[model samples]
Each structure stands twice: as structure tokens, then as C-alpha cells.
Target: MQEKLNQFNLLKKKSEKQVAIGLVIIVVATLLFLTMSSVGSEELGQMLGIIVGLIGGIVALVGAAGFSKVKRTFKTEVLSAFFSEVIPGTDYIPDRGLAPVEVYATEFLKRADRFHSEDLLKGKLDDVDFLSSDVRLEERHVQHTKNGTRVYYVPYFVGRVFRFTFNKEFEGYLQVLEAGSPLTNRDFQKVELESIDFNKKFKTYATTELSAFYVLTPDIMEAIFELEKRNPGRIGLSFAGENLYIAINNNKNTFEIKMFRTIDNAMMEGFKNDLMVIKDFIHTLKLNTKIFKRK
Candidate 1:
């Protein structure tokens, strides 16, 4: 792990140097072009400007490609090392293939017309089954132009979703979305829970009010609130059958390699802490408390 970290740092430093050189070249070219333009040689200045711009552009492209390569290498190595040495028994799959169609049937994800999942981390922790993945869902919007209709794919949701098996089966579906979320269903009416604070932060919708109250005990509500406080992202939750799905609206890729920054122990620790938040969900939510038993 140390060797891999050292290699990543070396590559990062080298990439930074290249980017610095590229920027210097572009700045110098711009200055020269302006100087030539001010000298009143119009044709000559234009020609020189074009030449210098092309050269600078090429150099910048090369630097960007080099940095991109180095970043990819560093991310691959460091993530592998982290999973192996730091969080053993967990496996990371780069491409999680297609997300299940059933996910779109959920209340919060109903807007998703196109879906893709990646960076999947699936494993069992202390007898609890869980799967975490970065999910990107898109919706198609058609615009009628003069020539033809243009189809544009806009992001419906780009975030991390954690799905874990619940200890007991649920008779009906229950969804708790962040306040003012767009997704809604007429079948699932809004449920007002006993906790005013929880109701303020979240809009609960369920097939039945009885099921909603049964599932969202006071302790569970407090745990959810605490989780939201710690992670300030918009959270969407759905409980159905024997599983609970949590979707956190965070667009930033987690555990990614920084191009100009060194991967130090502090950074690694931060990554571990983030992972721990996901890993500790079972304990934090008290999922195995047996509050809801199978019918």
C-alpha cells in the first residue's frame, strides 16, 4: 500500500508540473499575440497568433491527457489497495452494468427513464447484506426545433444508493423523500408522522398510514435525522418487501484520486470514515431490532 501511494504521489507531482508548464506556454503565447497585435502588423500578428495558439493548444491537450492517465492509474491502484488492505472482504466493481428496472418503479425514482450504476461495493458486514453503488438516472426531454425534434437527456438523479436487506418483510411500500422532491404518486398518500421535526425535513408517503407509523418508530426517526445531519445531502428512502433503499443525492465521485493533491494518511482516513458511515447503517438505523415482523 505504501509503495502504491508513493507511486501515485510521484505521478501526481509529475502531472502537476506538466499542467504548470502548459499554462505558462499559453500565457506567453497570449502575451506575444497581444504585443504583436499592438505593433500594427495585422496580417503578421494574425498568422503568428494562430501558430502560437495551435502550439499552446496542442501542449495543453497533451498535458490534460497526461494528467487524465495519471489520475486513472492512481485511482485504480489506490482504490484497489484501500479495498484490499483497508477494507478486506469487500469487492469493488467498476461497472455495475444496468440497474434493475424495479428501481424505477419506486416512488422517488419514478422519473428515471434511463439508468446506469457503477462503482458498486457489495458485501456482508456482521451478517447484514448490503449493496452500495453510484447510480446515474436520466430522463429524456424532446424539443421541437425548426429542422426536427431534438432529444435531450437530462439528469434525473446522480447519486449513491445503498440497498440493504431488512430483518423483516413489509406488507406494503413506504417512501420517505426529502421535502419538495419532485417524485410523487397518487396511490401513496402523504403521511404526517408524530415527530414534527421529521415531518418538516421529510415528506412521508405510504400505501397505508398504519404501515408507515409501524415502520417509522421514534428511534428510527431519530436515527434518520442524525444520519441526515451528519451527511447533509438530500436523502430518499423506500421500504418494500424485505429491503430498504437509501438514495443520497451527491454528485461528487467518492474515493476519487486528486490530480494535484497528494494522497496522504489523512485523506485515506477520510475515505475510510465515509465508508464507515455506509457500513454502520445497520447498527445506526437499528434495522435488526425486530420491530416489524413478517406477516
Candidate 2:
């Protein structure tokens, strides 16, 4: 993520420089034109004005070039950031020192292939019985006691959904991950292509905890566009005072998770530690059972 931020910073700095330079050129050209046309000599002043006009035209050209360059650069940065942050199983640090966790879930209402069929759920849940299963999840739920239960409210959706969130310290990592690496766009793309190991990364840092719940019910595609429009890029969805948000990328079939800091520590801690539980709960939904009820 640091790399991405660097890239963005580099591009932003370059843009600022170009703008400054463009303005300077314009100012110089205008000043020269005015000075050359002083009241002393009409012929000389006329020649001076012509020279200044040519210089001013050059300045205009430079200004336009600079402005266009910055515009394109900014656009690339925004798109690159969006993809990096929204992609499932990817974690990044933003420059502001905030750390965010992103989770992605995908579903298919109609089981067309093995990947999206009942067989898929059966295979994954071979060890667990589906005869009777249910749990209560809410803010009042006990912490660290429930084996397969969580206190998050999952969303309603079909196809796939992703969640992404971050703590204050990890902000820089996010900026870097989402923004792209200044060193190389190829490197940034490679990061996006790779898979993520949540446990491994979790152990490396003293991360703040946050939780986000998501639900995908097959016909979720109808809500995908709205989700994208409402949340846009890597930013998390705001639930009440809880900022731990979600990001959904349908094109790549990925989702991102982020936690806002305003949440109480206890709640954040519960969400962070119970990640596996949440995962299990999400996995269980793939089964054909009316037993799973939302609290």
C-alpha cells in the first residue's frame, strides 16, 4: 500500500508542479507583452505587443498541456485506487496511517455450474450437519463465547459482495494499496493479481478491530449497481455510527471490508477476532436451509 501512495503522491506532485509552471509562463508572457507596449514608442510598442502575443500563445499551449496531463493522471489514480481497494482478499495501508480489512463474497441465484451450485456448498460443509442450525447476532451478543456465531448483520444480495475497512494506523497502507505504487504500475497490478492471507498479515501489525456484515442472496445483482454508486471505491459503508464499510467490485467478482474507528473498542475487538466465525457464517448461507435466521 505504501507503494501505491507513493505513486499517487508522485503523480499529484507532478501535477502541482505543472500547474505552477503553466501559471508562471502565462504571467511572464502577459507582463512582457504589457511592458513592450509602453507609451514611449508606437512602432516599437507594436512590435513588442506582437512578440508578447506570440509568447502568450506559447504560454497558453503550455498551460493546456499541463492541465490535460494532470487531469489524466488524477483519473488514473482514482481508478487504480478503486480497483486495488475493492478487490477481495486484498489489504492495503493508506498514507494517513490507517489499516483496513477487506472481504469479498460472490453468489449466483441460479445454480448454473459447479462453482455456483448446491454441490459447491455441500462440498464445503461436508463436516457440518445442516439438519438444524441457527444463531442470534446483534450488539448485545456475548463475546468470544459463540463458536460459529457472530454479532454482525449481513447484507441481502445475490452474486457476490465485498467488504473493506481500516484502522487509523493502517491508513497509509490502504493509500498505497489502492493508489498504486509510484515505483511501477506493473507492480501495483501484480499486487492486485495476487491472493491475500488474512492471518499472516494480521499477526504482523497491532491492528485495531472492526466488523462488517454482508449477505448475498443470488438476486443481489439488482443491488450491485446501487452499492457501487453509493459506496464508490474502497471506502466502507457507514452503518449507524459504525463506519466499518464495504466495497463491491462486480467485474472482478470481489468485495472489500473496512472498519471505521468511531466504534467502541470492545465491539471492534469482537469483530476483528471473530473474523473466522463470520466467514463460517457466510459459508453456511450457501446451504439450502430455512434454519438460518437473521437477528
Candidate 3:
């Protein structure tokens, strides 16, 4: 990690120098063009302006490319190393396509028309196999304009999605999402539980009321409430078959490396805390408790 940080520092310095040089060239060219416009021919001023623009564009592009390369290297080396430390045997793939993301969205999210996933982490933790990645779900919208119809994607959800194998298989689907107007499928009927506080905090939906009650026991409800209290953002959960999907909607780019910033203990500590939250999910929700079994 320290070695990667040193490399990042060197790359940042090089990038900054290139950007400063580019800015200096642009400033000098602008001044020269102004001076020429006052005393020299308009053609000379135009030529100088064109030359300066080209030079500035090239320099800026080079600087941006250098910074991008450094950022990718830092993420792959430093950030991934940090995650590996937090969760041993974790494999970080910078880009592993969007098939897993699509599966997560279709099976759990059930929202958004476009999806993109990256920075995948696949491994096992405490006998539980899991796949996690930074997922961005966007909804495509079309606007009728004077010129023509324009279609673009608007991001509705951006966060990390975790899919892991549960301890046992169940018969029906269960969803525990934030309390509000329904966002899940209509097939899942809303379930009213005995706890008023739990009802206020979250809304339970499942294919059968008995299934909801069976999974969300008193202890599990308390754990769910505690998890929600720890994380104030939107939490979406789905259980189907032997797999559990959790989508944390925090609008954060997890495990991202900043090129301009120096890697420090505080930053690394923050990464540890974030990863620990995911790690704790396994224990916090008591997912390993095999109460339900397939008949």
C-alpha cells in the first residue's frame, strides 16, 4: 500500500507539472494573441490563436491521460489491497462486464432501464460465498425537443450491491425495504407485523404473510432495525431461493481512488470502515442462522 501510494504521488506530481505547463502555454498564447491584435495583422493574431488552442488542447489531453492512468493504478493496487486486507481472499476485478449487475438488478432492484457495474469483488467470507460490485442503475428518458428527440440516461440509483448465499433455502420471496409507497413488485403483498416500531422503520413485503413472519422473527427484526439505524440511507433486501441480495443506496463510488489526493491513514481507515459494514452484514443480520430448510 505504501509503495502504491508513493507511485501515486509521483504520478500526481508529473500530472500536475504537465497541467501547469499546459496552463502556462495557454496564458502565454492568449497574451501574445492580444498583443498581436493591437499592433500586428489580424491574420497573424488568428494564426497564433489557432496554434495556441491546439497546443493547449494537446497538453491538457496528455495531462488528463496521465492522471487517469495513475488513478486506475492506485485503485487496482492500493484500494484493492485495502479491501483484500479487510476481507481476505477477495479478488478485485476492475471491469468484469455487467452480467452480474444485470442479475442483481433483475432479481433484486427491479428498477432502472440501464445498468453498469464495475470494481467487482468475488470471494468467500466465513463459509459464505458472495459477489459484490459498484452498481449504477439509470433510467432512460426521451425528451421531445425542437431539433429532434433526445434520449439520455438519468441515474436513479448508485451504490454497492452484494449478493451472497444464505444458509438455507426458502419457499417464497421476501423483501424488506424502506417504509414508503410501494417500490417492489405487486406480487409481494404488504405484511403488517406486531411491532409498531419495526412497522414505522421498514415495510415488509412477501409472497405470503407466514413467510414474512417466519423470516422476520423478533430477533431478526431487532437486528434489521439496528442495521437501519447504523446506515441512514436506503436499504433494499430480497431473499429468493438460497441467495440474499442487499442493495445499499448511498450514492457513493465504493473503492474509488483519487489521483490528486495523497493516500493517508484516514483515507485507508475510511475504506476499512466501509468494508467492515459489509462484513458485519453477515453477522449483524444473523444470516448464518439456518432456521428455514428446504423440504
- Top lDDT: which candidate number? 3
Model 1, residue 266: C-alpha shift (Å): 1.7
Each model's lDDT comes to 0.76, 0.30, 0.77
lDDT of 2 at 135: 13
Q: Model 1 lDDT vs. the true structure?
A: 0.76
Models sorted by TM-score, best on top:
1, 3, 2
Q: What does candidate 2's lDDT look like per residue over 1-295, in tens digits?
A: 4565455455545545555565575566566556765655656756665675666566556655654564444334443354333333322221111111112111111111112101001111222221101111112333455476555433222222222211111211111112211121121111221123322221111111221112222222223223334433321222111112232222221111111112233433443332232233323332223244222
TM of each candidate vs. truth = 0.86, 0.26, 0.85
Tens digit of per-residue lDDT, candidate 3, span 1-295: 6776676788788987787788888888888788889986777987997799679868977997888787777777777777888799987787663465445543546566987888787888877778777888898999999999999998877887788777765688888888762378656788999999988878888989988888788987888888877875788778777777887788898766564567677778877777777678888877655555443
Tell how far residue 196 is off in model 3, in angstroms: 1.8
lDDT (tens digit, per residue) of candidate 1 on 1-295: 7787787788777767877777777777777778888988767777877777777777777777887887666556567557655556777765562266545535577646677777777777666677787778888999998999999899867777888887766588999888877766547878999999999999999999998998898988988888888776788888887888888886756666676778888888877876776666888887656645544
RMSD of each: 3.1, 23.1, 3.1
Q: Which candidate do you rate higher for lDDT, 1 or 3?
A: 3
True-vs-predicted CA distance for residue 245, candidate 1, Å: 0.8
Pick out the ten consecutive residues of candidate 2 with the lowest summed lDDT: 114-123
Q: Model 1 misses residue 248 by how many Å?
A: 0.9
